[model samples]
Target: MKRREFAALGLASLALPALAADAGFDGQVEAFLEALWRLDPDAAVAAGRFEFAPQITLPGSAQRDRQRAFLKHWLAEFENRSDATLSVSQRMDRAMLIAKINSDLWQLDTLREWAWNPANYNPAGPLDLLLNTDYAPLPERLKALKPRVAALPAFYRAAQASLAPNGGVTREHTELAIQQAPGVLGVLDDIAKRAAEAGQAATFKAPLAQARAAVNGYGAHLKRLLPSARRSFRIGAALYEAKFAHDIQSARTAKATYEIALQRREEVLAGMQAQAAALWPSVIGAEAPPADRFALIGRVIAKLSERHVARERFVDEIRAQIPQLEAWVRDHDLLNQDMSKPLAVRETPEYERGVAGASIEAPGPYRPQDKTYYNVTPLDELTPEQAESSLREYNHWILQILSIHEAIPGHYTQLVHANRVPGKVKALFGNGAMIEGWAVYGERMMIESGYGASPEMTLMWGKWHLRAVTNTLLDYSVHTGGMTEADALDLLMRQAFQTEREAREKWRRVQLTSVQLTSYFSGYSEIFVLREQLKAKSGPGGFDLKAFHEKFLGYGSAPVRLIAAEMIRS
Candidate 1:
C-alpha cells in the first residue's frame, strides 16, 4: 500500500488495536497514555495533545508521586492481562509499556533528577514543542499559550521548592537552565509579533507580557543559585546500571554493554584504517600508514574536512542534500518512500540550539498534517574559530551521512512510518533505542547499498559509527568508572577518531547526559544482528530488505528486543 493510504487508515483508526490483543488491554494502553500525559503536560504536548499545550508541568515532588501511582496502576492492568493469548505485536506493546513505567519509576525514585537537575525545570523544551509545531491555528495556539504563561511563576516556584536545598543541582544543569529560561521570553515576544502581524495581537498581548516577566524571574532564581551548584553529576554505577536496563530496555548490564562498545570501537577503527589505506595518497597525498593507525586515518579525514562547505552556507548545504538523499533512497529502494509525510529542512530555532548539530521534530501523531522539521543549527552564533571547527567536524562526507541519518532514511523517514502505526499509545511512547538504532542502521545500509559512492564517504561513516560506539564507552567510563575529561577526550578523539573540537563538545555533552549516549550503538547492534538472523532464516529469494524495514518500523518504535522477538515469531 502507498504511504498516504496507510496514513489515512492510521488516522482513521487510531482507537483500534494494532494487533489482536486482549481487547481490554488495548483500551488500557490508551488510558495509560492519556493518564501519563495529563500528569506531565510537557509530554502531552509532545504527543500532540493540543488541549494540554497551555499547561506547563507543575514541578514538585507531589507531581512525581502522583505520576508514580498512575504508572503502577496501569502497569498492573497491562501485567494482569495474559501475554500467552496476545498477538506478537500486542505482546511487544505489553513489554514496552511495562519497561516505560518501570523506567519512569526508577527515575522518580532512584535517579531523582527532579531534585538535582535544573535542566528539567527549563520551560524552553515544552514551550518550543508547543509554539513551533503548527498543530493548531496561530490564533488558537496563541490562545492556548495563555495558561502556560500564567502558570510560569508557579512553575518556577515549584522548581525552587523541588530542587535540593543549598544549590544541590549540578553546576552544568543550573548554568544551562539559567541560560535557557531567558530564551523562553524571546519566543513569547516572537509569538506576540506574529499575532500582531496576523491582526491577533490583542489575543496574545497580556499573557505574552506576563510570560516574559515570569521567564525573566525564573532566570534570576537559577542565576542566584549558580554559585552554590555542585560539580558532581554522575548517577553512579548502581543507578547507572538500573537506568541502562530501563532506558535501553535491554538485558545487558551497563558494564557488559560498555565492554561491547569498547570492542566495537576497535572494529570500526580497524575498518576506517583499511578503507584509508586503499584511498591513501589520493586522499591526503600519502600512500601508506604512518606506523600509527590513528594518525593515518586522522590525516585522511582531515582532507575530507578541508573539502567541507563554508560555515555561512552550512544550513543551506544541509537543505540542498535532502532532495539528493530522497532521490538516492528511492533509486536504491532502500525502503518505501513516504512523500505524503512532509519534511522541511530549516534553520534550528534559537531556543533549541546547544542540544544537537541536527535533529528532526516530527509532527505529533494526533496532528498528522503538520510538517516534520529537519532542524540544522546554523553557524551564525559561533565565533569564527568555533564555526570553522564545527564545519570541519561536520565535513562534506560526514554531512551526507548525517543527512541520511537525520533526514532521508533516518529519524524523519522512520517517524513518517511510525505515525501511520494504528495505535496512538505505541506511537506516543516510542522507544528511543529503536528510533536511534534504526537511524544508525540506516547509515550503514545506505553505504552498503552504494549511497556514498566513495571510499571517503564509507570511511567517514566508519568514524561516525565509531562515535556511536565510543559514546557508550564514554558515558559508562565517566559516570561509573570516574573517567576524567582528559580521559574522555582521548577516548573520543584518538580511539573514536573524532575531531578535537567534536571531542571537546562531547565532554560537555557527557557531563550533561548519561545512559542515553549508549542507545545508538546498543540499538543499532541489536537491529543489525536481527536483520542478519532474519535473512539467514528467510533463505534465497525470501528475504526482502524493504519489507523487513517496513514491518520492523510498523511495530511502532517498541524496544529493539521486543521488535526483534516479534520478527522472530513471524
Candidate 2:
C-alpha cells in the first residue's frame, strides 16, 4: 500500500485476510499486529518493519480517532477470547495486548500527551534510526525517508493544531521541545551528509531543507507558546494515580508504593550509615565523623563521589567497563550472559537528552540482531561546575554500578533475553518496572555476588540503591502530593546523596515526566520480594540464584508481579 493510503486506513478498512469469525486466535493476532503496525509506523519501524518506513502518523483528530477505533476493535476481539482455550503463551500475549490496548486508549482519550507535549511531535527518532542504523542500504533508507521528510511541514502544522490552548501546554514541555528542536536539525544534517555519501544529495536536498525549516519553525512556534504555557507540568493526583497504574502495572498501588519507598528509604539509610561509619577512617582519613548519621553518610559519599573519571574519559570509561562487568557476571555464574549480542556504548544523541543522563536504546524484537546502544550523555555539553558535579555523581564505584545497570547483566542483557523470548508482544510492550527493576535488582545482585565487594562498594551501592528508592518518593510526592523543588532537592542531595547537578536535573525530569521515576524501585522491590519468598520456600541450597534470575527474565519483560506468579506456579 502507498504510505498515505496505509496511514489513512482505519481499523475497519484495514486489509486483513481471514477476518471471518473462524479465523482462530493466531489469525486474529496476525491481523491485529498488521493493523497496529500500519497505524503506528514509528513502532513498526522500531520493530523492524521497514516497509512502513516512509509513513508518518500526523498528530491531529483524524489520526487519533482512527487509533481510538483501532484500539477498541482489537480490545474487544481480545476480550471476547476465552483464556482457557488459549495456549499459555497465547494467553500471556492476549492479556498483554489487551492491557496495551487499554493503555493506548487511556493515553489517547484521557492523557492526550499530543495536545500537551510538543516534544511528542518530533520525527527525529525513527528518522534517525533509519538513517543511521544500517538496517538497510543508504539509498533505500534515504529514498524511504524522502516522503516522510517531505511531510514534515504538515506534521508540524498538525502538531501546532493539536496543542491545547489556554494553559494546556506546560512551559517545561514547550521549553523541552525548543531545546530538542536542534536535534531534529541535527538529524537532518546527518541525513544530508549520508545522502551525499549515497550520491543522492541532490534528490534529498529540497525535502531535507524543507524538513529543517519546518523544525526551525516548530521551535519558533514553541518559543511563542512558552510565554502562554500556563499548564503546570504536574499531572496532579487523579492523573498520576491512573498513569501509575497503567505504566507501572505494579501489584501495589502508587500510594502503597510510595509508603513502601518511604520505608525502604529508612532501611537503605541505615545500611549506608553502617557502611560509611566502617569506611570513614579509610575514605575520610583523619576527619571526625559527624554526630548526625546523615551528615556522616553525606561526608563519606561526597568524598567517594569526588573519585570519578575525567570529563573527557566519561563515555569511553563506560565503554571499557562493559567487558569487565560481562566477565564478572560470567566468572560469578550469575544470569546467563549472551556473549554474541553487540553492546555499543555511545554518546547520547542530541534530541534524546534532557530526560535522563544515561539510558539503553535496545532494538525492538523484530530487529534483535541490531546493536543495543548504551547512551551516555557526554560531559562536554555541561558547564565546568555542572560537569564536575556529574563526574562526582557518577564516580568510580557508582559509574561501575551504572555500567552494570545500563549494560552487562542489566538492561542490555535483559533485553537480549527479552528479544529471544517466545512472544514478541512482551518484548515490544515491556513493563517499564520489570525492565528497570531488574536493572536495580541486578546492581544489588552483583554486589551480593561479590562484584566490587568492599565496604566502599557496598556503601556506594547503598547510595545508588537509595537513589532508586528516593526516585519513587520524589515522583509520587511531587505528582500526587505537590512536592516543592526545595524539599525535593533536599530529599535528593541530603538524603539520597545525589549531587546538586543530578538533583536539579531530576527535579526538571519529574516536571517533564510522570510515573517513570518510580519504575526502578517499584520493580526492584517486587522482584526482590519474590526471590526471597522462593528462596525461603525452597529451603537452603534448593533455590538457585542463577536459575531464579534466568526464569524471571525468561518471561520477557512482563510485570514483576506476573512473573512472580508464574515463578511460584512453576
Strongest candidate by lDDT: 2
Please write out the lDDT profile of model 2 over residues 1-570, one tens digit for every residue.
Answer: 001111110001111122123337778887887888999888798777788998878878999999989889889999998876665556667877888889999998898888899888878888888887787778888988899899999999999999998768999999999999888899899988988998999998889888888998989988888888988888989999899889898899999999999999888888888888998999889878998988999999998888889999999998899889888998999867767778788888898888888988877666677787888899997899999999999999999999888877787888777766654677777788888888899998998998988788889999889989999999998998899999999999988889999999999999988999999999999999999999999998899888787777766767777778767876
lDDT of all the models against the reference? 0.76, 0.83
List the candidate 1 regions with Cα displacement exceeding 4 Å.
Answer: 1-19, 54-57, 198-206, 286-289, 540-542
Provide the TM-score for each candidate, comma-separated.
0.93, 0.95
The whole-model C-alpha lDDT of candidate 1 against the native structure comes to 0.76
Clashing pairs in 1: 281-286
lDDT tens digits by residue: candidate 1, 77-153: 87787888776667777887787778777788878888888777767666666666666777777677767866777
RMSD of 2: 5.6
Error of 2 at 294 (Å): 1.3
Instruction: List the candidate 2 regions with Cα displacement exceeding 4 Å.
Output: 1-23
| Whole-model lDDT, model 2 | 0.83
